[model samples]
Target: MADPQSSQLPEDELTVPRAPLNKMIKELLPNVRVANDARELILNCCTEFIQLVSSEANDICNKQAKKTISPEHALQALDSLGFGDYLQECKSVLEECKTVAAKKRKASTRLENLGIPEEELLRQQQELFEKARQEQAAIEQQEWLQLQAAQAAQAQQQGLHLQPGMQPTAATGGHFQPYQVAEGIPQHGAVPSLNQPSSGAGQLPTESASNQQIPPS
Candidate 1:
């Protein structure tokens, strides 16, 4: 037999592969086929997406003081990201993935509940997982389209006259515009501290002209 260590993949190669990425894109856009360049772009996009999602998930894991990344952390990351409009779709996909994983776990661990044979159970579980993946791809495609439309609409409404080097933000409503404060200027509507004495403090109000005048006047 071949050496088990030789057959094992490196930890760095654990990321999603190209074939599955292409399949996912197809599921998202069934009618719109991607050419070679488009396929490359899709790969790049998927890489970026994975990087962002994983980073966000890592943040969630850190918050919980856990070292392992879990489905709950991933779901939280998806929710926390600026995908508010596509939250429902993302949530559905996450739930479906969880369900498929649960089914596989149950099939493997709970033999008593398996009315069917082991091989048949495994096959069925595999099919369920494939279906869940397809559904998720479709959901992601819809979300992308919605985002593009929103961004376009926002640009049109804003008239795209932004200063040089300043790009229009996505209309996801989570975008923040940076404000620069002049060196000595105070912020608008800032409340002064009550504990600090004002420049005009300790001075009494001046009497009115009529009260200050002599009685003969």
Candidate 2:
């Protein structure tokens, strides 16, 4: 027979569940149970392994861990491991963890920086293409203007059979070879026609002018 006094419960009371830390440690670690900082380290390792298995944190695991283990309790384990102001060794471990974490964060940031963002990279590429098109247009315009100038100069030269010295010399294209005309040829800025007989056609032979002609298409 059960003890009546101990077994009695109020009508509205609910059953309470019990947990023992030592039993929990033994169960969690399998064969390697210890009631000390070693146990805390084992627990930390188990947490890390679980997180690894998660690959990423899951809602269910997070809820469970959050409900079962308070941040204060987790930290107290660290505090026992000689971390922080409580122990000098603890301070070293804390600093080491901080350094490692900082390095990881820096590496992550570098990877992000090296990556090309979709929108911004495309915008920059578009801007570069536009600028190149503008430059090409300007170059084409300049070439067209130069072509017009050359054609005008050639047309003027062909109009009159101007001896080189007869007319005040018009500047020629840099590649235009100057023709030699007699120094004493008729001046007055007007050229005699090529068909017209010269006053002294063959009297004193003058060096004929030569021009570098571009090949016909």
Candidate 3:
């Protein structure tokens, strides 16, 4: 029996080639007619073995620059594989399709490269901040107004007691009155110790108007 270790893939195929174009194209294109045409084109070419895989070729064919590869290169790769015979006209169509798909992918990548939609997000955040600020300002304004009203009420109370008559104060619209000593009363200030009738002592004592002694009235 062949030794398993020695019989494992020979040195040539063992390097683990990525995108093994030759084998991949064969697998990709199964059509014999396409493969035949590709082979014939290659054989008929001039001394320069120009496999049409360059970016220029891709551009000429209008491939979108998504993958590092050109679509023309991809088709050529397919044609080079045994399946070239199957995809003559179809390969061109496939390349065009790939180009369109590539353009979309590239566009998507560009959008992703920019940060996630910050403009809309910032706008929403700004709106929230402004709303909060307006609410806070409104609250502050209300508090200030309330404080002013409270101060006005306190001033009115202080002024009421400081005035001449102890009658019902205008500030309170007579709702509150000073406490009275009697039924007809003046609680404080100089209005009247005069609630009392003018008896012998009640009237103001007056001296004679002229220098001469006046007769008794």
Candidate 4:
């Protein structure tokens, strides 16, 4: 039967969930059938038991000027409430929990887990950085050379002369050679005048010719 006082407590105070309580009861008494009212009674009793222990532990904590309840305080509360027969088992469980927690903390802080010494790690990082820097420098140098070559080629194509070192190939559409005249072409100063006749053609008489040939005329 459920306790009258537990039944009178507010729903919010019943923190023990019913489903786990019902499951536990079934596991403990598989062949025996339990009523729903019995299950409700068990649920309420578990909640009341937990509340009683926690309240006593809180009081013990306050008396010791502590704001939080530790596991020791809970154990003390259980002993004070006349459950000393369970103390040894609870202490063993608490020690096991603390051992597991310490192992986890130690594993988290161990430097050996990284598989490399600090100096070796730093050396590897420096090597990677140097490799990347060298690659970047080489790329920039190649790009600069390409730009200079392009500018030189453009100048040559525009008929501007360049030094031997700066000359580009004909494949780049540039002509760097000096200008030349073709064969059989006359020089600028040796060209003949159009107003003068050829030497073998009939000629007009000059003033000297008129003074000599007048008797024959």
Which candidate number has the best lDDT? Answer: 4
Cα-based lDDT for every prediction: 0.73, 0.57, 0.58, 0.79
Pairs in clash, predicted candidate 3: 31-86, 32-85, 33-85, 34-84, 34-85, 34-86, 35-84, 35-85, 35-86, 36-85
lDDT of 2 at 135: 100
* Cα error, candidate 3, residue 194 (Å): 20
In candidate 4, residue 151 scores what lDDT? 99
The residue pairs in collision within model 1 are: none
- Show where candidate 4 strays beyond 4 Å: 1-10, 99-217
In order of appearance, the predictions have TM-scores of 0.40, 0.24, 0.24, 0.41
Question: After superposition, which runs of candidate 2 have C-alpha atoms over 4 Å from their true positions?
Answer: 1-116, 160-217
Please give, for residues 12-95, the per-residue lDDT of candidate 1 as tens digits. 463468889888888999999689898877677776677687888887888898878887787788789975566678779888
> Which scores greater on TM-score, model 1 or model 3?
1
Candidate 2 has an lDDT of 0.57
How high is the lDDT of residue 131 in model 4? 100
Residues 5-56, model 2: lDDT tens digits: 3445762232222235456766777887465786556555655543332322
How much does candidate 2 score in TM-score? 0.24
Q: Arrange candidates, best lDDT first.
A: 4, 1, 3, 2
Candidate 3 lDDT over residue span 79-174, tens digit each: 655447656776778879889999999988886787669687689889999999999999999999999999989978756445443466568776
Candidate structures ordered by TM-score, highest first: 4, 1, 3, 2
Clash totals, every prediction: 0, 4, 10, 0
